[model samples]
Target: MNSDTPQLKSFRSFEARQDGDRQTSRSESYLRTGRESSVISATIQADSTGRDMSIDLDVSADATHLKRFVVSVDFGTTFSSISFLILPRNTPPDSLDPHILYHHIQTIDHFPEEPCLGLAESRKEVPTEIWYPKEEYLEDSIMGDGTGSDDSPEGDMPFHLQNEDEENTYWGYEVYSCQRIDTDPNQNRRMGGFKLLFDESELTAQIRLDLEPTLDMMKKKKIIKDREDVISHYLKHLFSHAKEELSEKHEYTNDCPLGFVLCVPPIWTPKACRIMQTNMVRAIQESGYGSFGNCIDNLFIVSEPEAAAAYVIESTTTVLPKEAFMLLDAGGGTVDAITYTVNQTCPLRLEAEGVEAGGALCGSSYLNKAFQEHLSARLKDEDYLERNGISIRSIVDTEVVKFENNIKRKIDIIRPTSVFEFVEIQDLRADPRKNFGRNRLRLTHNDLRGIFLPVLEKVSGLMERQLELAKMRRINVTKVILIGGFANSPSLRSFLKRKLASIKSYQDEDIPLWARRRFLVPSSEPSTRETGRDASAVQVMDFDVMNRSILMTSLLTGESFPIASLWMAGST
Candidate 1:
């Protein structure tokens, strides 16, 4: 709990005085600084609350001796992850190396099944999904069981849980697997997209229709008592898994000093941010962190875009002095864009107020929706299959969606002949119609483009708006950095490159609008070459938020003290 750390005394000693007298003393101190007169005037105006501006630079100079751990949680809309750095006793903070310093907690390691479709390798992140079995089904299973107790036999529990309640309450991978196998949707209630409900305006009619069943189930079962409870329940499971992993890996004790930083969308209003923070604090407290003695006081909130900027500025080698750049964080639920001007390169002083900031609800999930709609339309158009009483919606959801998610990553926009064959349905096998020839779905370049065009257009528009603002401010934005889960989309990357290239070459009556901006994306593989002390040793992780969280954790813990000072000054 650094919040209770002692404040620095003023350089000049003074006797106890009234509030008015203290304001006069602070104004006098400001006037006596002998710096720029405008700066002094601005300082006085900024401190209207009469709070002290002094800071003790050496407050954490001796903190290196303390045994502590820094942890960051990215509670994302589609998937959530946690990354952490451990500072052992007597380890000097300055000597820490980022290349091997951070570790992803791998939250879904012990899941009953793999989480997402086509994920062959183990992943550090977990699906932000939960499933609640119907009360009738639970009761039936309990009555049918030979053992009356809630406890299951060792090694017989699904997901290896100790109690039967956990078996009925599934999360992450189990939700997906259960939904696919059990056609009776009422048997298990699976819930996703609850994260988007934080902003009420973003809750569309379609989204509401999709969430109604789960919401009703949650209410009836008391799985979620309120909107905040939805987030708290998920977070409690996430943190509990993280605590177990950390305790085993580092042998962490109850007394170990631990700090948690949570990342939120930059475009969230102050009200939304406060709500999220309150729920997060409540979640941590209810997760049994309170027994560890004031651990909750160490919680910090950082904007997602700000954290991404910190990582790009510190980890990249090509970022130039005074160079401006645009960051596009296209996540599952939203896309946020921010433009930054680097004021200093050595200690990294970035413009606090961005040249422009914008966001939209259009994200990668919308592509899936569009694809689902397209398939539904095709099924509707072809009457040959409907005559046989085949349900098109079931075929699309259970079969087509899985194939789409897998191949969407490998789609080549330039290849017009690239075909995606639909998984054969036995009902369609007997119907030999021209439209259903070979039981294959032919995806032309235009068809493929159509699937992604709606989302890509929204993203491109956001970037264009940010670029226009930068131009209006006369900022020579040098680079465009892409991050988040949607950044992994090849179609998105290609679309942006083509769109930006056109804008760069577009002659506005012989004036190039955006000729100098360079597009940069994170490489999948880590670099092996060392850049020495002048450059950061941290290699970018596959997960963008994890990398950003690592940098944010370091910044918050005074490892990069000067950057923190600059951040505070900029906030003022």
Candidate 2:
């Protein structure tokens, strides 16, 4: 003990309890006026989440010394997002609130190679992907579309994935743009959807089945030792980038205690959380974030959907007093549906929540998969029609990407298109008799409907299930706020509206989803600043327990399930 401080006595009594989804604590210290003796009794009531999180503390006036420098991560299938906030370290807890915390949250939008891609503004998240390069492609690794393998005149390759660089492991934006020459590791190796594998153990075997050839090549070519090697290595890179961004902005060298908020997928099991936590800790330790224990206090875990819901409800003007809203987190590879009813307005307390899930992996990526399959099957016989199969393959690749970026999101409710012509492939080949092509490309609206139906069916089912749960709980879904990357698709939005129109509880409202302001123009701010229903931490520390900091990480991720520009009264 410091000489000026009073010596503490033994423990008197400690009490803990739960109240819905809120955590509150108060402590009273009894100190004798004589020599030095003190007794502290604390009653901490935290949200009784069945997980290992069980602490809420009261920081004394003297303990509020250092500023809370916060950094958060969302490791997703399609993209990974990071954001940070630096509150005045010396201030006490009473001075800080949710509103003050909202403005300071800044997303790490300026990635290494993002500027040159010609984006009008900064991107909220980097693609969650990794690639290992072959020694043979020294001529260059072109990023954007080129005429052919030998015909690259001008291109914008990712800055982090240069052929001249010594590093072979490329990650994030590095892998986002780079092309995979062949399946063989002798040519190159690329991997995504690794985050999904964290949910299941045998996912390793399943992934091996899909990437058996490429993975086997990576093993033989000595790029990666095994499957875990790829995961751990990829995670290390992600942590390193986050460390760099945090360090540069705040001059934070891990000198002070770091509060980390790791968001868990909604459908993740307890076993899966443990596995992901271990890998995250290891990745942080290896990324030079100091010794993991020294920097990180507790791995604040949160459900992605809930965290996102909290962020939207708090930051925006959209308020639902004693009303339920369906929070649909439609990401790249997964869609999670949950309903939360606001019980109070002052502090925004949610009473009843219904979490009904869709398929394990159901999201917009299925549509991409469907479109790719359509192209492959439709173009396979073209090898006999013309010797330009290689060119045709290149065109299909470009067209598929174009569809994912543009066409997929354009399927709206108000205006609908009948035929979509190929921008690249203008050929006289098969499917001219039907409306599958115009320049040999007349893909009718029905053709697209056939491709979009499967994914739409699954997503619609998720919404319906959530609605049913809400009805069962007697909570009418007054509004539906859709987040996540996939929400940008108007087709999915339109389909869900039609599917749920007949539901009695919903009453066939306009039900506008929060899916605007991403591509055409971004939000006035950067990220969404999501709220955490599962674990919304405040990062209040006592600096006791031998300098252990108590971290409350409300790692609200607005970008991961991006919500900006609210709509009400079922307005579009």
Alpha-carbon lDDT, every model: 0.50, 0.50
How does model 2 fare in lDDT? Answer: 0.50
- For candidate 2, write residues 434-552 as lDDT tens digits: 43443555566666877888888887777777777767766667767776767767777777777656665645455545543221001111112223222112111111111111222
Q: For model 1, how does the per-residue alpha-carbon lDDT over 116-226 read when each residue is reduced to its tens digit?
A: 433333344566777765652323222211121222111111111225565676776667676666654553266777666555554344675667676776656655544
Pairs that collide in candidate 1 are none
Q: Which ranges of candidate 1 are over 4 A from the true structure?
A: 1-68, 90-112, 115-120, 136-163, 200-217, 247-256, 269-271, 285-290, 352-354, 380-392, 414-421, 424-427, 430-444, 505-572
Q: Give candidate 1's TM-score.
A: 0.66
lDDT score at residue 6, model 2, on the 0-100 scale: 15
Prediction 1 global C-alpha lDDT: 0.50
Assess the local accuracy of residue 292 in candidate 1 as a C-alpha lDDT between 0 and 100: 34
